[model samples]
Target: MLGFLTARQAGLDDPLRLRRAESTRRVLSLTLNPDRDVDRVHGNGVNAIDIDAVEGRYMLSGGADGVIVIYDLENFSGKPQYTCKAVCTVGRSSRHVHKFSVETVQWYPYDTGMFVSSSFDKTMKVWDTETLKPAEVFEFEDNVYSHHLSPIARKHSLIAVGTKNPKIQLCDLKSGSRIHVLQGHRAEVLAVRWSPRYEHILATASADSKVKVWDVRRASGSVLTLDQHNGDKSKASSEAVNTAHNGRVNGLCFTGDGLHLLTTGTDDRMRLWNSATGENTLVNYGKVCNESRKRLQFTVSRGCSPEFVFVPCGSSVAVYALHTGELVTMLRGHYNNVDCCEFHTDYQELYSGGKDCNILAWVPILRTADVEEESNSAPTRAVGQASVNPAFQDAWSSDED
Candidate 1:
């Protein structure tokens, strides 16, 4: 319907004629409903949010007040305005729960029974969702910034953890141990991500202003180091290594296809790059304010013709078109600086949090007609799920192999 509207609104009779224009972009926003009343939260602020990709109807949020809450994302109350209900929470009573701010939270890509959280207390705890207890805990020497479990790594069930130490530790889930460290940067490693396109590939953005792409299977050298000032067309071998940003690189997010990467730096810039080539695309997102001393948690929209990037600005979230570098619009609601944002492609919704002690939800503007048509066309699935992603493949390979 969107494509049809784009073509008909332009009075273009042919499909080929409709494909060339750049004005087809659309912007919409739906007000978010918080899990509790706006004044009810402990009010320390929200830190992290994780939307269940497989089910898409449940999510988890960790707060600076050290509370972990699960929310149901469905329209169960049959009201005009739907509220996100709190399904469960890890309250202050749990002795082993994180004592300080929970910096990051993520679900095991393949399972609903397991989730992970890292805190300023220097520990990463893996929890059994049903039992709501720490199944395994890994201690660290410094504050952990972020950690990621490879979405499609089947051979190696490892979680890559970033910290103030500048080294990224790969923890093996099955063995319940730290396997090995990937060391390079001289400052804090703020963000760590495994390539969705390749199992052994890893990318790290550091406080040192450098973004390094590594082939985890190799110990001899880095595969590529990104430099922003290098000529756009120059290959990694031809460009000067390091110097990707003038300051700390705060945000690291990959497009849904994982062929490209989006980075935001304290240098107040955002750049897109070819993930495989390690070459910058040179899309100029003008002076995006990234005050995050820690890496920013941004998300990319999926399924759109040209996807968009959602990033947290001062007290609002800015939406920008990928590849084109055009600012779409800003989402305004939070009173304090927004820290993180997550996108849910299945329902065309966005969830973002900040230091304002509130989590705001955004969605495309929907009419009574659109909602009715959607309800008539399909049935909504129950929140949460059984089984795991078959997409999981072992990523473990010995140096000899």
Candidate 2:
């Protein structure tokens, strides 16, 4: 760590190199923080969560009880112990609240004044943040599973929505109507995401065990369908032809640059893919343990040397080396199954929600002065030593029950 600083001070290293090194170090030291907490605002499981890109200080969460909340993540009290308070909420008392489980919630990419949410009640609502009311509501015939708005789109205001119907719907915020539909999947569409790099490119995952990428401008059909076998005729069986997984694909997320895509499935597997060519990178993330019938929300870290992927695995959040498929650590806190996780890139923090009806904050531990002195003296101590936090130790016994 001192070597990188010295080289940076001497103008012998790229500034980005120092930044990446520090970011990677912080990610490796993440643990469930005992001081920081998020207020419990939902009566049921949290289905989705998102951090706003504009300020990164406000977080939005959707719950199975049809509640939505916005939390203030910034700590201004000059204290280490802080609880992120809910600034506002759309409670069940509100007439505009969804009638069923709120499946997905996302902030407007360019501004915080407007946001969107989709629900199992078969409607997607565009909300006015200040008013806490729906500005526009688009009704559908089937339950909505997931939806996404392009973060880099400058030429369009379309929201890609996945639902119980196989076809993906494109809703226009400008025209206040469903403008187009991309038809290809054979079962319920489980997840949808727009590329951060290109405005027109979109990806969709379905229960039929297929993932398809589309160029919405073409209006013909899907441009590519991910094949786990990499198009090898002999290795792929007839039933597995052009399938991304052996079961339902419930999660989809792109790396920060949108160059690669990560997916989770009911087959207890997660696969990485090359976004452009639709080729499976074949990096084996062993046994992700996904059993959700609805969309699972996961995320990736930005501005790190070797980027990391965070996915909800059972009751814990699994951190993996993005390119190498190495399991770095498991953040355990929730007692029930986890459903969603979001990375706060600027602060190097993580927030996860689960069926336990809790939102846990995972913060990086500060490097102690004693550890630094020991590292300087020994110069051979392993950097990846196991954590000594008592919360990490398992205490469950077979005789308890």
Candidate 3:
């Protein structure tokens, strides 16, 4: 560790090398933080969770009880242990509360002043953070499954929405209307995600066992329909016929760089793909036990070498290497099936919520070796330097005269 520090300080190693090493170690050391547990406010199962893109200080959670809660994750008590209390909530008594389960909740990418939530009631409502009132409402003919606003989009303020309807809706936040719809999937569109790399590129997953990538700018339809076989019809198995999965594809997430995409399905499998070409990179993440009939919410780690994907597996959160498909660890805290997991990239921490009506915080375990090393070396280094350096000798002078 000292050698690593010396090399890092001397500029002979990548500055991020130390950080990556620490991040990796921290990830491997992830443990349930009892001190940082969030207050259980939801009356029913939590359906979704999201950390804001801007400040990352506040977290949003939607529950099956039709409640939306915002929690302030910052510890202001100056104590080692502190509970993350709910700052505000759209309770059942609220007139603006969703009439049914809130399927998805997300903060506006650019600001925390606004947020959006979609529900099984067939409506997506945008709320003002300060007023706790709906700023805009999008009505649909079918149950809304999932929705997302591009964190990197500058050309437009569009929210990609998937629903029980096969068509994916793009709602314009700036114009306050449905901007357009992308049509390709044959079954209910379960998940929709905008590319982190290109503002116009979007990915949609559906119950029809297909994942399609569309260029919203082009009206001709999806640019590519992900096929496991890479168009090898002769060698294509039934499972490889222009489908991303063999069962309902319920989850979709892009890697931090937007160069790759990850999808999970009821087939108990997860696949990684090149976003540019839609070719299944075929990183075989074996049997990722998923049984959700609704959208599965998962997230990928950011700013870490060999990033990890955190997916809800039954009552636990499964952590796997993003590209290598190796299971890293299982966070087994939830008493019921975990519905959603959110990652805090800044601290490499994880927050997960589930039917158990609990939110668990997984934080990196702090290694004591460095602290011990510093403590053990401090006096020795000072004494050793006192012999040669006048500054150290003066600081330690017994004869003050």
Question: Evaluated with lDDT, which candidate comes out highest?
Answer: 2
RMSD of each: 10.7, 7.0, 9.7
Residue 94, candidate 1: how far off, in angstroms? 1.0
- Model 1 CA lDDT for position 264: 86
lDDT of 2 by residue, 231-332 (tens): 997998899999999999999999999999999999999999999999999998898999899999999999986789999999999988899887878888
Question: What C-alpha lDDT, on a 0 to 100 scale, does residue 8 get in candidate 2?
Answer: 82
Q: Model 2 misses residue 271 by how many Å?
A: 0.6
Candidates in order, TM-scores: namely 0.83, 0.92, 0.91
Total backbone clashes of candidate 2, pairs 3 or more residues apart or in separate chains: 0
Model 2 accuracy (lDDT, Cα): 0.90
Off by over 4 Å in 2: 370-401
The digit string of per-residue lDDT tens for model 3 on 1-401 reads 56558887898988786687667656656778755769899999999999988888999999999999999999998765789999999999999999999999999988999999999999999999999999999999999999999988999899999999999999999899998988888999999999988999999999999999999999889999998778888867765689888899999999989999999999999999999988889887788999999999999987766688999999988888888887776788789999999999888999999999998888775556553655443321111100112432232232211
Q: Name the lDDT of candidate 3.
A: 0.87
Compared with the true structure, model 3 gives a TM-score of: 0.91
Question: Which pairs in model 1 have colliding backbones?
Answer: 154-393, 154-394, 154-395, 155-393, 155-394, 155-395, 155-396, 156-395, 156-396, 250-296
